[model samples]
Target: MVHTKLKYTPYFSISSFTFIMIRLMLLVCVLVSFAAAIPWLSPAYWLSPRAWPCPEDAAIAPCTCYADDDLNLFMDCQNLDSFQQLVDIFQVDFPFKKFGRLQISNSDLRDTLTAAVFPDGFMFREVIMFSNNFLDVDPDTFLPSKTELTFMEFSDPTPNFPLPAELTQLPELREAVLSVNCSEIPAWASDSLVTLTIRCLQDTEFPSPLNLSHLSALHLHHTNLLGVPVNSFVGSPGLQTLSLNNDQLASFDDGALSFTALHQLDISSNALTTMPQLTCGCEIQWLLGEDDATMPLIGIQNVTLVCDDGSGKFDDIRNVLDQLC
Candidate 1:
């Protein structure tokens, strides 16, 4: 009889174990990707704002609400034929009252926009109204969203266009763009406001001084402003960019540019015979015009500058000003 001895063999070596783990990890990654690619397969989809049901189409006929990429909901209404249609749209019961944005454009809707246009307790972060003829915008129209509204824009050529007085009550408001025929910028009282743009449809004036504490950028175009009044921007200590383009500015009032943080002053397409005095110690860029063109492309153009002091278009603004700092 011969004794037979058998050698023990392990089910898996160290390398084999590592390989199995790698394969398992790859399978998990693939499964996760598949789940993410298919909205119905992911838990996030169930938790997203998209999961929230929107109102029926018939209920909000002219307007539509959908979730944005950031998961916030946007309500867009375009080509509204009449203000009654707007009234009918808001009269519907919305399952979701909190919206990220509200846009209304290219419509015959006119006259006053009262609080009735927006349902009570409804909140919006942004509001845009363009190409409409709203002669009177009631101050309480945006009262419900005073705390949540961050951005607002309104456009149209309405003489004596009334800016909403409730704008000053909005604590979270940041940017406002008004393209109307107003005489002056109101004394905006928002501490959170950062940018303001007024595209005057007619000649405008700065009858009052700006008193914003946190404003950084301001653009005034087609205002036909004759000159910057004294203390025009005295309260905006943090203002950095000031653009007064397509106006009739011939000179700046004494100490108009006294702010310390002004970095860019664009006075192009104006009637300036001489450079506006620069008081800021920081280096400033004075935009003169678009090179080889009568007008500048919106947000895209080659800016050209000519030093009035005979420095010959120097890159350093100090050279143009002949001030050594």
Candidate 2:
């Protein structure tokens, strides 16, 4: 039997196996590199552009994109036109956790946003919607179950025809600034509002059961108010600052404000002939009244009388207000 010696070239076999292992390792490295480059490889990787894509477009010029983690501070989203665009950029799906800040000011948006657009427990801290021409706003549009919003601003140049009742449901809101028509104030506002500023209120009479017990400041500037009940500020235990400057107010119901926490009061440049005897006590610091020499200093620290004195000293009402501030 001739035993054919098969060529047992162990060296070549070992070299071949080593080459295959090296190739496999190199292939894995290349795959990982490609996977890492995918995010930067395409400009389309980011969401599409709408009315306002970048923060810069939203009047927050020189906008900076925040990471998912930095949500403790306030988020400014002023002047962003398209609400849908914001939802895409934030990657906010239903049942969202928490969002930092959102600003949608001076936009043409007229509809209310739904909870489905936000994450669960939609924790939105600050929201500003100023100068939007929204005729109507649904209260439920901002209500996120179990979420607590701190600050909200809705200052529109256009009149808000009527606001929904759902706004009263947001008990977690702390500070709010609403400069719209008097008709928009929901009946429940006095109950839930803590700090409120209502400018240009056209109504002649105040709402019943004024539940501003927790209100700190009340701004009713540039309104057509003729008279306010003396007990208007009765239940407002935390009332600190009150401004009724530049109004057509003729009289304030005697003892109209019994605010215990009353600190600053401004009723300057009004049609008021006699200043309401404010029993605001020594807590009153600043007093602004019409420019009349008969202006009595009722324990008020600084008083700016806006009278029709021929000296033109009282003509600068706005400058006086600024200096007081």
Candidate 3:
């Protein structure tokens, strides 16, 4: 075995060690910069606020955005003097495109409410308009929110007004209340419409041939309807409640109450001399029990109801003639 003297060599020199450390530090710096570029990886991003809850007040002046604790947003633009002001206000950029509810009441926004009145991407779940005089609305005014809108109301006697025929296009619309001056229910087919209330401000008869298949409740108030025509409710075969309160109705066609779903029929405060003939199916429970004289109906206790199923379906019309509580 030959033993040789081993030469002593250091693992690394000082310069070499320093160079390796520098390379390691550079790699760490690169990794740190990459992490900072990603918002989810940065700790500061999580601590910072994401966005402002509502729009700035000055940007939407006269119209206010209200944010609830549950984060629902509502916009109220009521009593605006000019229609131009409304158009100008919507021209500003809104932080949110969706609102829970929109209200415009007692505003002098005359002429036509076109699609330009709303922001480009604006949508509302509920829209209420009241006391807007001489204002005509475009058919496509609410087309953008056709899927989002659920409730709509146009009350308080708008003259020369027509119910927006475009409302039939909304698939999600559920309830609607309208005050008609000269409007009539256009040919519409809605599957989601459940309740409808129409207040006739002028002397008008009932609108026939309604196409609301999903309509469960129908209320006609303050109308000059003399009688209900035959097959008046043929389109709304699913209607369960029918109210003709506060109308000048004297006669009702037997075909009007021929649907099978109608259980509650209210003709209180009307001028009916005799009980209207019924041809519906289901147990009929007359709300009148021989003592209620406030209603104009005569011999209601003795009138016979014809049932399609021979179950003796009854009509439960409330005796409270003036008040539908």
TM-score of each: 0.69, 0.58, 0.70
> In model 1, what is the error at residue 249, expressed in angstroms?
1.0
Judge candidate 3 against the unseen true structure and give its global Cα lDDT, from 0 to 1. Answer: 0.68
Misplaced by over 4 Å in model 2 are 1-64, 67-97, 110-122, 157-168, 189-193, 201-204, 275-325
- The lDDT for every candidate, in the order shown, is 0.70, 0.55, 0.68
TM-score of 2: 0.58
Error of 1 at 250 (Å): 1.7
Candidate 2 local distance difference test against the native:
0.55
Tens-digit lDDT track of model 2 for 1-325: 8998887656545578899999999987886677576543334434545221223233334223343444343345545566565456455222234556766665565655555555455566677777656555545556663256767777754445223455556766777777765543443454556777666556545654466667887777776666676566666767777877777777666566455556567777776666555332322222323443422234333322324244534326434444554
Candidate achieving higher TM-score, 1 or 3: 3
In candidate 3, stretches whose alpha carbon ends up further than 4 angstroms from where it belongs are 1-51, 159-167, 276-302, 305-325
Error of 3 at 221 (Å): 1.4
- Give lDDT tens digits, candidate 3, residues 42-150: 5554465543345567777788877788777888887788888888888876767798998887888766777778867999899898876645666567878987999
Cα deviation at 163, candidate 3, in Å, is: 5.3
